[model samples]
Target: MRVGNWIKLSHLSAGFIAVLVGYTSSVAIIFQAAHAAGATDAELNSWMWALGIGMGISCIGLSLRYRSPVLTAWSTPGAALLATSLSGLTMEQATGVFLFSSLLITLSGVTGWFQNLMQHMPRHIAGAMLAGILLRFSMDLFLAMQTQWLLAGLMFLTFLLARIWLPRYTVPLALVAGIACAASLGLIQADGLAWFPATPRFMKPEFSWSALVGVGVPLFIVTMTSQNVPGLAVLRANGYQIPATPLISWTGALGVVLAPFGGFAFNLAAITAAICMSPDADPDPRQRYKASIWAGVFYLLTGIFGATVVGLFAAFPVELIAAIAGIALLGTLGNSLALALSDEHGREAALVTFVCTASGMSLLGIGSAFWGLVFGMSVHLMLRRSIR
Candidate 1:
């Protein structure tokens, strides 16, 4: 097929929105994580470069290979873990911890243990978990309206109208509306934007049992459970049958190679992947990979100009990002809910998972997604006999 035949305005919009939401949401945590490691300014830029390049390559290559929308992201939860846990460790030791965690992730994939575990995951449970994971973003749409009513409200109204009149372009149109409203309201700020390319800085690794056990192990666990699990669920929930093994293995491998340059962790993306997988990205699911390809292109651009891109994204008001992200995800959120509740037998268990995950409760440094699945599966198994 010709490139023009597959590419659409909606795909580009979805790609841009996915990157925008991914960066704006958790980038501050990355900064905090860097600070915890006592990283210099240049090292922080290198971290962004490594993460951006890793994600870009993974996303583009995997999507093309699998003919599916495969998105990857830096491990936000892992960054959060590092932010608090990296205090005593020097930068070299921290790099070692990252490598150790990534090695574990690679092993999990290479051994097929992670794939086997996910292969048995019930569809309803996966759908519920995905819905639970995205609940916060959708809720933020209305929340943004409370703070910037005119801006967010206009974007939402545009979304509703576009869905009725031009269904495929709904998200793109809503995003444009948000940007226009923000600009009119004097909310767009680009006062001190700098344009500089990012350069990678590699640090030598220094391993220790304490750092590995305390930091590395937890990062591996969190990245796998919190990020990759939900990411696979997002794919399965959206009807993609791409195998998990390669996806996990490739991300882990990339993480290991890039760790010295501040690529702390790389895993499948949950929320952003949904944006690419949704119908709003492309009416035909087979062509949705184009959306992710565009996302990868944007990721490359972000990596090439790391600090500049961050500042550019910062220029947009928070309400605009929140509104557009929520609007774009509306279709995905609705569909996930439908799938989660479609089966009468698993409805209760799925509902349990949805609520638990949506509650956003984390325990023992692990995220709610893991706990939610545990509670959901337990309820599912217990109720299985009764439903029969």
Candidate 2:
């Protein structure tokens, strides 16, 4: 490859770490959710297959077609929702709920109603909502240092040096250094490496009314209201000019078809997806779509090596993962915080938004993500007629 092309490939390679971090740091809840729903090992692997393929197709196809950094991810909070709500559900019943909710998502996307509502929302409130969502995860980075100082410190330094010196591959390079330190110190084990390809398992869907009520409806609501809305906001906030409705439709439709086989849910990614979309990763915004493509490729590779890599990531102490993810998000959180505080007229309302979201309250079984949006929007409308 030529020098420029090699640079492109390396940039693409950096995106793999983003995919890995996104999956490992918080997404493990999905597996637990599957287990809670009575999924077997085969069923779990099937879920990985479905989610990987669904995300890969959406990330690759949509990004290429639109020439923007459109990425899809399994909803983390939705997975968390499943982990709690799927406790007594059967696999087939969970699948039924997945399908039902996916249809609702697709309909919402097709109607374009959600986008309209979000568009009318104040920019400050939107920024506040974004900050609130990322606040805990970002704060955890330094907090992680409190527990695993040696591991997190080295990774932190590696990231700092890379950012100051290399500038292009800070997070990925930091991961390399962190892993080396972790392995040598016996803090993490990557001893026996198996690279067997994962086989896809097919699940035949069966519906149950109780599972649909308990699992499906909430999953759909959380994924759409929390994940998809915020993911699109990340794009729009950064001035990515893509049609939200189409992307939403694509994500929902993919989930519907893939859910029965273990694809629990799919939506736009906000935190990790921002990494692929940002100018920091790639200088030219037009070329940033390649990052999402790279993320998709890595997502496929992850599914291929499914359990082995998952073990590798898991071997690293929780604080190590927490520190890495937290530090990685610091820049994003700072920017979001700044945006939240920027609007003078909206500052008070934004504070209300931030406070409500930061409080992390959930009403009607929905998570804080949805409530943050609601409270923030409510405060904004009451504080100023401009939002109303």
Candidate 3:
């Protein structure tokens, strides 16, 4: 595609906002992971750098290559896994683990193992997993009201009114309105807001076979099966058909560069990326790649004001975050749930997948995401084979 036929700056701005909203709203939990790992401010910025650089390259490169919306973000579930699992490991040790994990995921993508697994996923089950992923965020909308009534209520109302009247601008406009209300209401925190830009610190790579297996292996599995697989599915379902090899390689290279800077690992986003890539984002699909690009630009901004930006994100009330996110995801969640249960032949297995994932059950340290897919696919295949 010629540069003239491609999106203009205006469309790029819109696309960036779509990604910024999608990525930031969901990644608040990343702070928890950083804190749990005892990361210093520099390391935190490194985390941002790793994540931002990775995401920025992927957004610009992937969208340019696929000519579709290919917004990638850090794996939220993997972040959650780290928040729980990073306690005992040193930052350097964790870095070692991060590097090892990323290499494995890169290999999976290159060897087509990851792609092969995704090809086996039934449409219905994929849909169910998508729905299951969004289910928590959707529920967060209402839950946020209990803590910050006025702030969340206003945002919720803004979302509802815009959704009813002008669906396209609901999220962007509501986000602006929420910031205004927050600033006026004294909800914005200026304390400890730093001067000067972030300085990223680098750590040399170290290796430990024990840490590799204990932490690295789990990280790779969680990032791949739970994050990237479904992330690609989002792109495919939306009709973008970029080959998978380059996407994986790029993500891995980004990981390698950022690992020393407290970037645990980066992977394809499933739920959050869906938010930026959805039809609800804008009526024009060709234009949607702009969202990922815009998201990348914002991510770059995030890298600059790494410290203060976290505070800015903190300003929005939980209710507003949840409401905006949930409202944004309405179309995606609905679509996934519909597909998950729609196939009679795959119904039983898909239902198992949805129920198990939704149940939030974990066994032997494996997430429900992996097991849910496993359970669903097992039943799906069994049912298929029996029919033959």
CA lDDT of each prediction against the hidden true structure = 0.82, 0.72, 0.70
lDDT by residue (1-388, candidate 1, tens digit) is: 7878657899898888888768755675577678889988788888888988988898899999999999999987677567656876799999999999999899999998676654677878877876776677678889998999999899889889987998656766777788788888899998988899999998999998777876787577667766898899899999999888888899999989999999999999998889899898998999999999999999998898887765665688887876776776576679778989999989999999889877766556444666677899899999997768
Residue pairs with colliding backbones in model 3 are 15-290, 15-291, 16-294, 16-295
As a TM-score, model 3 comes out at 0.72
* Best-to-worst ranking by TM-score: 3, 2, 1
Which is the leading candidate under lDDT? 1
What is the per-residue lDDT of model 2 for residues 1-388, given as tens digits with 9 covering 90 to 100? 4657424764585467568667754554565577778887667777777777788888888888987888789887666556656665667777887888788788889997666655776667766755665676667777877877778888889888987898656766767777787777788756654666666776777777656654566566557666887888899987897887888888889988987787778899887788887775688888888888888887887767665654555567676666666666566567767878899878887777677666666555444545666667776777677655
**Superposed model 1: Cα runs more than 4 Å off:** 1-47, 59-105, 165-168, 199-248, 259-298, 362-366
Ranking by lDDT: 1, 2, 3
Ten residues in sequence with the least summed lDDT for candidate 2: 361-370
**Candidate 1: residue 30 lDDT (0-100):** 77
Regarding TM-score, does 1 or 2 come out ahead? 2
TM-score for each model: 0.66, 0.70, 0.72
